[model samples]
Target: MTTKFGFTLMSIQEFETWIDARQLARTVLTIQEHHTYSPAYTQFNGSNHFALQQGMKNYHVNANGWSDIGQHFTTFPDGTIMTGRSLEKSPACVVGQNANAICIENLGNFDSGKDAMTPAHRDTIIRITAKLCKRFRLPVNTNSIVYHHWFDLSTGERNNGTKNNKTCPGTSFFGGNKVADCVANFLPLVTQAGAPAAPVISASAVLKYVSVTASSLNIRTKPNASSPKATDRDAAALGAILRVYKETNGWYKISGSQEHWVLGKYTTDVKRATVKADTLNARSGPGTTFQKLGSYTKGQELFIVKEQNGWCKVNMDDRWVSKDYLVFA
Candidate 1:
């Protein structure tokens, strides 16, 4: 195994072993499959793994204004896997559907008239996905493993290519990028490779929403301070709403399918509310004497973190607004 730009480049076998041994602290409900349409097969020279990875990172950071590469991992035509973003944080892929997702970008255009998929690369994609499903206890299905073509290019809705969408993962990726194509061709291979699917948990029905009150809150693998941190450097950003499935001691399990937990002390049960005032001042403190942070227009929705002295704290930071200007849902 070799490391480049803080990313680990590993063989398929090494990746399988490494992922299997890892104890993921964050919850991952979906695995996204994408194709790098720009950096076609010709860009890879077998030994330029680090260079290519760095180039992509630089583009993502400089052009896209993202902190790092969007995808969690990239698969090469030579059957190599290079890590990208940290698994703890949400990926930048798929816009609004990034939360709780692990994105995999296969290096090379897989369109029918574009780069032809190699046998080694094809086998590696199948097995690596299977290994991830097995290790993460994810079911091999359309909902669990998704294609970029399935979502809307603008709104990020799961339209399944019925409307405006990019032919990502390709027009002929694994036969096709449609949901039916995945069900018929791709999922069967993954199921065969990683047999006996893990049991699915039905915990979504019991989840309750809560808003983070602290500027940044830590997520843990277990509901205790001794447990390892589930997220990367920064905590869950202020105003981030998380769904809680279970509560123990004072910690809440934030993930329905994974053992991700966060402290309840820094969170508050919130209700969605809309701004009633045409232009309301967002303050740094609860009183009118506090500095103004910003302003919200009428009908703008925000989560009410807490209320103090007729002022409602609207975000995880010190941003507050008068409760008189909020219409709770």
Candidate 2:
């Protein structure tokens, strides 16, 4: 149950620390540092302020605050990479399960009617993603990475329709193919046989464009480092425009921002995207489940270590779990 990024297999705790830290060394800035407001923020009419604050508080509680175990690892917008929960710990970012995946918080209101993210933000996310892919051995492609919306438990209603009526990451974020594209861009860097080919972008090429339907994306600079120089960047607000430049080893080196990288799995490309349940309660038997065994829910993105019949055998929270409990989005 582990997610490989570069040569590293970040445990749940390590991943959580990364989110709280907001390691920007691997991030890029989409919008310039001094911007007025984010379009996505304005569009989200829900409790965006409450959401952000609550998310931050929750992250702290699960990883930093009372828990002191660090749950998430990083936060976008300010581009600061703080450390959070350990690989063995769990987080509260998501409902029901988070024992495996590290939840990252991107500042801004995603539910708002407008898009709040910028290209620079994407660049940062791509590079960080690329590095993680190489470290954990997870596929850098979009197929493995997923959005908050896409993460659904087996007990919850299908397609994110649940009786609890929870709204995570918001509809604006992780709405469409954007998460896929992010993973796609980063996968190449890790999968490349050797050094990646030079960026195939032209200076005259217009900035590639994608809508930041979500409130935020995890942006990085070098993919695996933590430095203020690399972390410095304005948050990607809603409705902000961005341009794509070139793809590198498991990363999308953006053109709009100085030089930023985003994880390949979070983009719109046609990488295989699927949603899986966190450590599903395993039973000695069946029917409403039998005895509850240990559980896992590690890694932001996981590689399909193995799969079979209606089930996919995958690493759980950097460990192994039963495939029968898994379900795709």
Candidate 3:
């Protein structure tokens, strides 16, 4: 039989209710430990303390195998979630640390085999990680989330002093970490209101190109003129795909592509051929200024529907801009 940590789904109201129900006598982890992943019938590696103590590296056992508790949680191949060591209390998943971090043991050995991680596992990690981040007030993306390998990298230590054969989460699941990064990239900005100052992708990752040009560009907030604003943000390159949310005017309103501004002036070129060319230039009035507002290159993409007298109407990347701009590209 499998046990589940009983956590009620939390909303602001639900959180308040939980707070009202408790007098702060227990830790936060104890109050909300719902969600769990059960141990399935699978072969086990002798990576537990018992195996380590016996100088053996692999072993087989009952459904509830390990001699000592391992992992703060388990994510099944089927995507179910399970609890292990207390969330508030640290566990020994990463070596030399059991006081500050939580351990989640995912099944599979990507380091030595060709078996791939199931979609169920990837989805579970994403859901659970987001929940953990929300509960801890941590940023919800790659910048905040890290892999065990990252922990190892930052610590500058090897797992048990051996480097040749210690593959923990497997290579396939390592890719799952990238998936987590992608999720972290979009969630927060999507949940917020108003336009971002520029494309501010909360997380970092690769972006594909959709369009291109070669002139210097500005990122504005609203897609209108008389808004009278030009951001220091640049997006002037060829084939450069900076993570971005939307493009208005000739400028691209990028607030969800990266954590900061890459600007239109600095991009190199557009990479993809399918990307449609649509650049809105910053105009004086509705559409009288033959003068150029800004420019852009390939790999940058934006939508254009609003229009004013030969001028294309679009929003700016900055919040202060109240009007749109126009461009002829």
Candidate 4:
């Protein structure tokens, strides 16, 4: 690995090995494809990986006011991989979709009639994407592997290359940046590169709701401490409600479009219920004799951790309320 500006540049094989050994603490669901629009192909000298990386970092940090370079990795025309932002943090790529994502910024602009993609770069991109899919157990599809062109540039909503979107990965990236283009020209190669089939969650698996008890909990790509992290701050936070799909070895797999697992030890499994009363007191204990912690609005979602004597524990903490004011979900 070549280190510069505290970032490591690696060959595809090295990257594969490095990522294989990492243990992340967040959940990641999507892989975003983007092109460095400004730098273009001519800026690269084929060996200035460090210089280019530092330049991008300066821009992202100073101009954009981001904590670091926006993407997790950068792919060069020669197929070298340069690490950027922390994999543990969410990328500042697509606005609303940055949660649970890993972003890749290709070195050259790829718009139609722009820089021609080199054979090495094309092969590397495909291989790296496939490797990530296999490592994270993500299915090769439009949802799991996404293009920046699919979102609105302003509002950051998924519009499928419709109104107000930038041609990001680019207008000519892999035949086109639309969802149909991915299905036709991109996903097949990713599948051929050996993306594993998605695991099927059985109906027999009991579904449970839970709230994060830790100040910041790690959402993993798999149900173990050795797995890479998946979700960043956008998707997970203290008191955030998460749906548990399955359980294994004290880890709970969260219900979502992707495979995200969190340690059950850091979360409190609860029943989802809404408030029935216009205003109900949240107490320090299960009975009315307990101190009033606060009051909740009607229709507010409450996590019922434990039920007792017509009262429900609203959180992992000792907050409770009468069961009569709650409508169990």
For model 3, how does the per-residue alpha-carbon lDDT over 1-329 read when each residue is reduced to its tens digit?
A: 23323222232233333323321100111111111111222443322322221221122123336543555555545555444443323344443223224555654444434545566555555555544444433443332343444223223222221332233444344342232433454344322412222324335332332222333333344555444333433333332233344544343444443223323444433221211333223333454434333332222223232344433432221111012331223
Cα lDDT, all candidates:
0.78, 0.37, 0.34, 0.78
Off by over 4 Å in 2: 1-55, 58-70, 112-115, 141-143, 152-167, 174-285, 288-329
Cα RMSD (Å) between model 4 and the true structure? 11.0
How do the residues 139-256 of candidate 2 rate in per-residue lDDT, one tens digit apiece?
Answer: 4333334344433443221133233333434444433223343335434543453212222333345333332323554456654335222345444432222344566664555444
User: Worst ten-residue run, lDDT, model 4?
Assistant: 197-206
Report the candidate with higher lDDT, 1 versus 3. 1
Residue 37 displacement (Å), model 1: 0.5
Ranking by lDDT: 1, 4, 2, 3
What would the per-residue lDDT of candidate 1 be over residues 190-303, giving only the tens digit for each residue?
888873365455536545668666766887889999999874333565446676789999999876667888899988786667778876777778999997655655655566
Once fitted onto the true fold, the runs of candidate 3 whose alpha carbons sit more than 4 angstroms away are 1-68, 141-143, 151-165, 174-329
In candidate 3, residue 2 scores what lDDT? 32
User: Would you estimate the TM-scores of all the predictions?
Assistant: 0.69, 0.38, 0.35, 0.66
Clash pairs of candidate 4?
Answer: 26-229, 26-230, 26-231, 27-230, 27-231, 28-230, 28-231
Instruction: List CA RMSD, all candidates.
Output: 9.3, 16.6, 20.4, 11.0
